[model samples]
Target: MDKIHLTFSQKIIVNVFRQVRIIKGNLVHQKYFFILKHEMQLSEFKYMIHDLGPYSYDLSGDVEYLLQNDILQKYDGQISVGNNILDKVDDIDLEEDEIEKKIAHISSFIQQLFDRTLVSEKNIELAGSILILLWDQEIYVKSEIWEKIKKWKPGFFSLIEFDSVWDILYHKKLISKEVYIPNNYIERLKCLNSGSKNAREYYRLIEKFFRYIFKNELNNFVLKEYWCDGNKKIDFSAENVAKKGIFKKMSKYSSSPINTIPILCKNQDRELFGSDLVESYELLNYEFSNIAFLTIRSFEHDQWILDEMTRFYRENDKKSIKKILFLLQDIDLIDMVEFRLRGIEPSGILKEKLRSVITNRNVVPCS
Candidate 1:
């Protein structure tokens, strides 16, 4: 009789089965185990962003191989590596230094996942989904973390509580407090600095630049050729999620209803006058649409737009004054994003801009 040898991965698969009883042949535990392996720097498998969570084809292949080799055994709604196979691997006398350490950690972590009093599938789904976001979403803010989870899987939002999941992961030291830092500053700066002066290209570049820079600020703030408010079309509109950070501050100081703060974006043309922006203002008639951002490549119209913004604010009452217009130029946007990337809260930059628009004669360049 020849002794059987087990690959490193097969041994891990075996150990994961030994500690945790994955009910009903649920294959997701394989992916969960691999995540532990990846986090511990034990495996190099890549994961795809699946609806349920991160899925790995390579890990699937390993599981299939183990099953075919009879190393993995399944029976009666449970799966495990047979005792005979486990004994065979023991006879091989493989080094257990790292593998045992990882399996022990993994096995311990698995116990934290389920509530022993009752089994809930949603908790399992929440665990995997949260891991995927924490691993790849780069979301640091606590509120945004929950918002993103709800946005990704609204059905589970009822079951997934921030305090509950966060406490478990935080207490376990699996996660650390994080801060937001925007990326591709140089690339975006170049695009804003120099791009097709053509109106269409300018609009596209503006969208790309803003979206890339302030993505962490809020999700889905950019839209193209989007129509809303009585079917009146605008280049785009931004629904700023207030009640947090700078947006919250704006509401408190401005003494305005910041809920549903709609910032409108208008496609640009090299017009001599700021008349084109009037179309942007008109779109604010939509219920709760209060703010507007106009991206201009040519600073030639900066002063002109500034003057026009004042005229509109003055003619309108406080209700309309709260609905302000911001002039977003290349340099100003670069400055805003740069401040955020350099560990400055972007909300401060925005506050200054809105302050300048409200109090000072000059625009703060889109706060």
Candidate 2:
């Protein structure tokens, strides 16, 4: 069997605090308390390994330790626990009862912390639910940032706490009970951790979260329509003709000239530079009357392309050559926004945007 390789992000997580484990036959000895006791210099630990790189592993046993330490607890009976029979020096068969018992205990601990955890909706949308849960909870206090929140919600701490909550909820073994804590607790908890200034950062995080979701949705929308799947282009087209020159001359005889719409879709974290829109311009320049630029941010068309487009529009007044640009901010396509000019221009709200742009066009420009 081939060994599965973790991504660059996974390696950093495995080494975050390393580990101290001793397994004896069926007995497992993951002495988490001992590790924390030896490495409890939280501030030093964070500073020493400040940059954890990209991917991080979920320190499962760490949460177990947190629950055992009583810092957090779960809702009643959400998870089950079992007797610590393996802790003794008895040689025993692996029975279902024993397995369930161990899982119950572990699950109970995990669920308790899961219930008590606080996550920001923003971090959940950005870093993803996984990172949010895997983030070490001690960072807030260890960095002296905890004192910064003047006002807070009941359960969650500062902004970062929301990230932790997101991770936990993301992969919780028991998803049914992973309840979302209301904003009230989030707001109150913000004040308690870091004071007024810290609270503001938390507030901003929440705001950014809404923005991110909206942007993410919009990006997804444009991608769904324009992104290429396999070798087939998103809006693939080809024309058949008897003789190229004769067809061109005879086709010029149509009462209504055929217009193609070239669409280019770019989904990137960085800005969409002017060069990214070149291909779209070329495809639609002559055969098409309009080009649509789709991206999460502004579509910066090259100067030459811009100049050509301006000239084309200036010359083709009757044909109405135009460029339509769709830029989504920190919002997802699920939300509604003004986009009437670019065809039917349905924001994130409906599939109508797809119908409007593709229905009457001779060409479709896609990423």
Candidate 3:
């Protein structure tokens, strides 16, 4: 007879059942086996599954196959080890000790996969810190976790960042998914032992890991803004404007310029501007010589809109005297200021000038 070929899912289900039976030393409830199978599907094999709105798995089908093949026996709403499985267990290669060791090796590999999916270096640092804190404390209360993080590094993280790190750790099995302690306490303890080390050394090792992984373009890499749309009008709403200004350096180095309008308010009549607008104006003033403001309101109005024109002069100023002389005629300080103020009140000519200057200076070579 040909040897039975088990699919990946079938193998996982069989292993889950085998482990349960070995640990329990007797028959196991069908519900308990199903629960373990479902958990493995969601956590270890989630990426392999297809979505049908809700996640689906073939645990039941695999179980039926196992029963038909005499690998498992069903009786009185419970599952038990069958003669075939017992004989297989007695096989030297499939002994209980060997199966456990294989399971542990596979689990470690799955954990590495989970760690690779972390979104950013900032997240990795925070996750590592929280893991260490949990190791030292050994408490899993939600409130206690937050308190510990704050006490360790005040204002270093926001609530959203904390929640994100916690979620990642839970999914990776470094922390228990259950909200309270004593739930998966044994597993949590094991995580602490595995991850616990000298704090500074751990951080140093993580930095080296990232450096190795991103070594390809570490010297000449430029930040790219993939989310930016060239044709989309720049949102001057308070939040959008503030974000743009805060990340202005990132936008400046991008391969393309972000399209922008002067200012937009939720209520057109209110004419409100956020502090970010003022900060952007100050930073632009510090960077450009010809860009001067007569008043704070003028800065808020639209004086900084001519930054593209000023940036061109700043770049040319560093070149030869001949180049400076040739660019002098093109650098219109008075006209640029006038155009900026006019743009605030909505003029077609000023808008055209703004668009032309912005497009021409959209991307400048890094110095």
Candidate 4:
């Protein structure tokens, strides 16, 4: 069996099989396994894994999250399906037609799951949740598997010739239903009663809000205005998902609009804030276009930092690039782009000086 490097979606299936094999391979668990086996013997399964969830759920009361995501595969463990169905094969000495008949019987069971469960909209939502859970794993579902589930219904098979493919998946422990408790009235009530007034929290929330705006609202900006524009000066817009690495995987339901400027979302406090003017100058000087400085803290770039940034630009002779800082609360825009440059590694010192220039009250009365 080949080892499968599962995506988040595939992990659900792989983990189910891995867990079952672990249980089956355990000598101490044999008694419980037989109890499960005996029950499975009576079921009309075309393959074996359909019974594992109920067996484990009956014992543990908690469903495994991995099984629910379709992330598992045979390579996770050495497991097989059809032993129960095939046990009588030798006794019957099956002819070719007889073998085909048995195969069809098994295939039908597998077909039911694909047709009934996976392709349903409910399961797609489940898939989305799984992706969210696996967010840290950096697994993304592309359009191919997305469309596959969209077309599934109960009793539908991807291919008629394949016997027991779907059931085998279940029996071999590659996929299992993950039971989730839906939000109740209490959760709804709790959601309604929530509000945070902290200054830093407010800044973070505001920054988060723009992320949604840039993703959803800005997509059309690129398509209609930027793409068709005669200048073609806009190589790419701020809202492009591919360019905005983190936003690529955000939930489509999020209220972010794709903006014409690059947006970064940082969730941190205000007093511990870093210099934006400095960072922006470094980024822009490095020719990192379409950048947006977004943070959950107050946008207070210091005076030395701003001065250093402006001086650096003048020194480099690329003064055309503009600097504008927007305060999320009042939409206050400030341009503090003048000060002397002083630092070690030109970039690092440049950042420090730019912030100092922007935020410093004295300004050093530069001539």
Best by lDDT: 1
Each prediction's total of clashing residue pairs, residues at least 3 apart in sequence or on different chains, is 1, 50, 0, 64
Which digits, one per residue and each the tens of the lDDT, describe model 2 over residues 165-267? 4345435532221122222223333333333334334333433322332332222121122323342223222232223232233235434443332333333
**Which ten-residue region of model 1 has the weakest summed lDDT?**
177-186
- In candidate 2, what residue range of length 10 has the lowest lDDT sum? 20-29
Question: How large an RMSD does model 1 have?
Answer: 15.3
Candidate 2 global lDDT: 0.31
1 or 4, greater by lDDT: 1
TM-score of each: 0.47, 0.26, 0.29, 0.22
Count of backbone collisions within predicted model 3: 0
What are the per-residue Cα lDDT tens digits for candidate 1 across 113-181? 554411355555565666666766654444455677777767655633544665566555556533222
Per-residue lDDT of 1-367 in model 4, one digit per residue for the tens? 3332333222222222333433222211222232232333422211111211112332221122222322211223323221232232122222355433433443343334334544442332333223222222222222222233335333332332111333333353432321111111112222222222343333333333333333332343221113223432121124444443333322122333323344333333343233544544444434344234433233355444445544543443332333333222112100110010011111222244334534555434334
Q: What CA RMSD would candidate 4 show?
A: 21.4
Superposed Cα deviation of residue 233, candidate 3 (Å): 30
Ranking by lDDT: 1, 3, 2, 4
Best-performing candidate as measured by TM-score: 1
lDDT-wise, the better of 1 and 3 is: 1
